[model samples]
Target chain A: MLEYFEILGQEVYKVLFLLVPILVSVAMIVWLDRRVWGLVQKRRGPNVVGPFGLFQTLADALKYIFKEIIIPASANKVVFILAPIITMTLALVAWAVIPMSEDLVLSDINVGILYLFAVSSLGVYGIIMGGWASNSKYPFLGAIRSAAQMVSYEVSIGIIIINVLLCVGSLNLKDIVLAQKDLWYVIPLFPMFVVFFISALAETNRPPFDLPEAEAELVAGYQTEYSGMMYAMFWLGEYANILLMCAMGSILFLGGWLPIIDIYPLNLVPAPIWMILKILFLFFLFALIKAIVPRYRYDQLMRLGWKIFLPFSLIYLVLTASFLFYFDKLPKGNF
Target chain B: MIAHSIFFYFFSVIAIFSSLMVITSRSTINSVFFLILDFISVGCLFIMVGAEFLGMILLIVYVGAVAVLFLFVVMMLNVAEQKQSWFVGKKSNHLPTGLIVSILILLELLVVAGGWKYKENLMSSSTLILSDISNTHQLGLVMYTDYILYFQLAGIILLLSMIGAILLTFRKRSGVKKQSYFTQISRNPSSAIELKEVESNKGVIIDD
Candidate 1:
């Protein structure tokens, strides 16, 4: 065992180093979500709690840790216990593939986009499992709605991604950012930017598309039976997914770690700072939209996804393909 | 090289076992989840083989979308045993299937061990060089240049699948009202109708 540990010496350090930012980002996002949402509603927003609610989530976490976990009498024992763990784990794992900076990524795998998508899709299982395991009608209904809603929007999201992938010619997030060094793809692919952003909101089950959590109907949706820390896991995972999506959007469309106001005759800030700033801006946008937009009826939401966004993205993909083919002669960097 | 080979074998065993469980499981829902696990392991195997692009495609398209949809419907319709007949059968055909699967596994093991004499340059020469093209660069190059036609073929396949799915599920139900785009767009109420009134039961009111 000692020899094996020696063999894996630096690998352990690399793993731990990778874990820091992921943990920090999830923690900060949890704090930010509560504070921001509270402020938007014209409330005191955790000011008296501990230094502007910085420690509110932490306090809540501790409270959950000490609380008794009660399984409902009719609940499925094994799945009920495992669902939140899986949900939280998958949500955290997605941050591994996200490129925070050039060298800051953990996995930096080739199929980063696909990995992100796959992990998020698995998240739906967590919701489904939680709902079904509870043996309750409302959660079951919420799970079904979530399954349909996520699946429907994913199609348009995938197609819009095709358009962006065509522009970058790579699936790796770092490579996508490097491709955007000259100009972000948002300039030319503005429509795709819109499609991807909206689809991401839908994908993360944010407000307006948040049918799964429609409190008036499902009484907190798939989490109706959850209490204490189990509920906290679901909450953490939700905000984490939002943060992950924002990070990916920043990296993919917003030139990731590139400075927006590059007026200093050179890009000065480290890539990670720019990445953080871009993510914060996108995060604010996400919260703003959540506050401003009214939830659509279920049918209207489905129609928007399947009818409008899907067809539009397919057309965008075709246009992108045609341009890439026709301009094959152009110098790769010139444009 | 030995570590990589051992990891590959380990994941392959798990993948194969989970895949078998996917078929043999009693509950349709359990079977679906097992199938997801199998696909994830298969994806890991794909990565081990330096086929990252294909692995990602398998992850995104099948495990992410198709398998989730399968699980979703299985859990939703809550099909009774009657409806599960197509998927779950207690018939005793497992023996033959098991035999066939074991035979294939044995053959693969034989090939891996020494039957093919394929182990000579398996690691030293190829392993170091494999890392260079293992990323998306070579995959993109081949996709855009050599396999461009095949890429287009995949697009056509997806398009066909889209149309097929829509056609299969778009049937209008009998009682549920659906809006017609034509009526909504082209309707001029003045052209279609003239207003009139009739006497009410209580008031005996009338209008022209």
Candidate 2:
């Protein structure tokens, strides 16, 4: 009983430790995204808050908190409220398996990648429920688009991950990183990496593929009926998911906590810092894509996902598997 | 052990309750939402039982893909307003048949559970769950080696279903103007542009 209590206490402590940093990072990421956009468009971004607008997210949080949450009379009240909570909870929970360093991570589960995949795939529920519960046409349309978009992209992402898994031969995130000690999977699996990155963009509903919440057509899409903290929850959940995808990209292809080079100077930095740096770099690319690329038309987005990325990733998966098998480079395991 | 049982009961109760709600919910959308809840709780139960890979797969495939598909259909059909009472709205001749089929299924499940003790020697099978390997690794070893044909057959079935769905929904609309990339890109400046000397007070006649 005492041992159980101790384990429970430790888990609570770890969760808090993990969650605080993540929440803080998410807030900063929101601000960073805006600033990056502003810089690309040649404008000053959010200079009114704390130094360099560091506390802008805090002000936004307070504004959302104090604002009234309006539940539409026509809406399914229970589901309407439940959607954002589900989104936020799933977004945060996926971090449990993400290792920051060798010693870090709340739960270093064997199937960490699959756990992330599951949580991300489940994210569609929040949007679908929210849109449906709103009892509005635009939200419904948005939900339908999201359902089709996410499902389409997930197939390609699954194939792309399998390409990496064939080489690593382990589902464990840590083992995936360690396996890339000599050479990151990005070098050999460059095409799949690109496919995975673009798919990740779509998976997180980032711009270009953010047809679900396209402002012009759907008027905020699934979030049309949301307000106050509920809306903020969705926003926060989105950034958190983006961060999760960046972390995933870093772990699978960019070698999670591994240094760029095995030389003395590059390896001098700590593992966790290297991991954070890679994630930030990926996030920078994410923000850059958002700034540069125009939003994709619905048909074009579907075509890109199904016709281009899906077949490409499938072929890549087959190529990777056969190459690994022929070269005897497939990691030996229990299988 | 206490923690394990506690979580087991917790997840199982939610799973059972949500599954009941899935059937009993008035709105079709609400039913789909409850179905998702049921899948999630059942997935939690699978994870708690140490089949983490299967648990995540359940969440990803069933709750994520299948339930979202259900929600999409429910929302698209706009059936939320059709709040018909179960077994009360109209005379349903199939109710007796449904009841009988459901009861038989329950009976079979009960028999399977209750008769487990009599099959003590059933544990001596060729394929045993290895304690050392991860569930995913075990699955791969069995699936890729012994059950490869069956796995490929399943893949073929899914592919056929996908092809069938696409073929069923696909239609050629005559009035719509579709973009033809080949024609659009193939035309050069000389072919696309035409310059003609126009006579005074006369418009240049262009050939279509």
Candidate 3:
């Protein structure tokens, strides 16, 4: 019994170690986004209370926990509650497969890339359910737009990822990073990187693709009826997914923990630090894009996703596959 | 052994319970949601079987698309809530279906636990050789080199399904105006409507 207990305890410790970093990482990303936005806009962001407002998310969490959670009288009780839970859970689960550093992943499964994409797509269900459960016109309309928007962008996103998978010849995140050992794939696949970045922003419902929650139109969109901790969960999940995407993009296109040019003791900074720095840069890039770009109209976004991005991604996929084939890089007979 | 056995029993019970609920739930929408839960549990079972790719695909494609479409259709339908209540008094009528499902569930458990040959197979292969090395390369090698033809077949099936769905939705209606470039080119405003000037009988030459 003691021996068995030891094994189970070890498993629990591993799970805990994985979960804590992600939670703290999410908090850090939110704080950094706010502080950096302030710097960029030439204003101090939340400097009053705790040191640089590092405790801002903590304070907000306490408020959310204490706030009255309102379930709309007209809403479907079951789905309304389950929707946010599902959304947050999916967002958290995706990070399980994303490799932070070379060997630091929680579940380094064979199909890590596919698993990430699959879980992320599951997020659309939560959005759809939340909107439908609200039993209101605005939420319903927002849900419809979200469904169309997600589906459209996901097609392009899938195609773009095919290019990455082709370049690496493996679906594992660690392997993908390893493939970038010589030169970061972004140097060669700059156009695909741009396409993947923009499509990812749209996929995550960031600015320029936030028509589903367009304040002037839908009035908070699918989350119109949510309140208290449930709403906070949704917000946190959104930011976390953004962070996860940045981490993934870094792992896929950038050299991940591998240094740029490997000059002057690149080993001095720990692998984890390098990964964090890369993710932070990508996170700032996301915010900068948001600050600069205005929201697109619904039709325009759909057209861009389908007409422009999808074709380019498909072409990129073809190019990648062909290049791999020409170089005899694919596991033979695939081509 | 006890811990492993407990988890297996627990997840199995959950999977069975959720699947039964999928059929028993009153609302079609609720049933569809339950179906998703059932799929997730099955996905868990796949994970236990060391078929992670298959498990993820089950979640990705079936739960994500097919079940979603099921929910969409159910939600969009104008089924009356009262009609759902009509079958409440006829519980006995559903006894056969329930009995059959329970039997099926029992069979599934027996099969999963290896019924008769389970001991033999367990004796033969107790340890699966999965080392610290990543399995992605081997899987890719097998999938591409050995199973490429099967993969292409799956793609063809998907293509066929897409075409079938499109055909079903493509309905032509009579008396609906269809666009034509030639008609637009030949059109003139004067030919489409008549304009006339009349002498004014009242003040200020009224345009009526």
The numbered model that scores best in TM-score is 2
Can you list each candidate's DockQ?
Answer: 0.40, 0.65, 0.30
In candidate 1, which residue pairs get closer than 3 Å at backbone N, Cα or C atoms, i.e. clash? none
At residue A22, give the lDDT of candidate 3: 80
Query: Candidate 2 on A1-335: residue-level lDDT in tens?
Result: 89888988988998999999999999999899999998999988877899999999999999999999999999989989999999999999999999999978788888988988888998998888899889999998998899899999999999888888888888999899999999999999999889999999999999989999999999999999999999999999999999999999999999999999889999889999999999999999999999999999998888899888988898888888888889988789543
Q: Report the poorest 10 consecutive residues by lDDT, candidate 1 chain A.
A: A326-335
Scored by DockQ, the top model is 2
True contacts kept of each: 0.58, 0.84, 0.48
Ten contiguous residues with the weakest lDDT in model 2 chain A: A326-335
DockQ-wise, the better of 1 and 2 is 2
In the range A128-192, model 1's lDDT, one tens digit per residue, is: 88988888999888888888888888888778777877787667778888888788978888998
- State how far residue B196 of model 3 sits from its true place (Å): 21
- The models' CA-based lDDT, in order, is 0.80, 0.88, 0.79
lDDT of 2: 0.88
Off by over 4 Å in 1: A1-4, A7-9, A327-335, B77-131, B134-165, B179-208
Task: Give the alpha carbon lDDT tens digit for every residue of B1-208 in model 3.
Answer: 4654566577778889988998788777788887888888788766665566677778878886677778777777754754555465544566799899999999999888875553322212122225543344556568888999999999999999999999999998888755554687888997755655655884343333
CAPRI class of candidate 2: medium
What's the true lDDT of residue A102 in model 3?
75
| TM-score for candidate 1, residues paired by index | 0.84
Error of 1 at A235 (Å): 1.2
Screening candidate 3 with a backbone cut-off below 3 angstroms (N, C-alpha, C), the clashing residue pairs are none
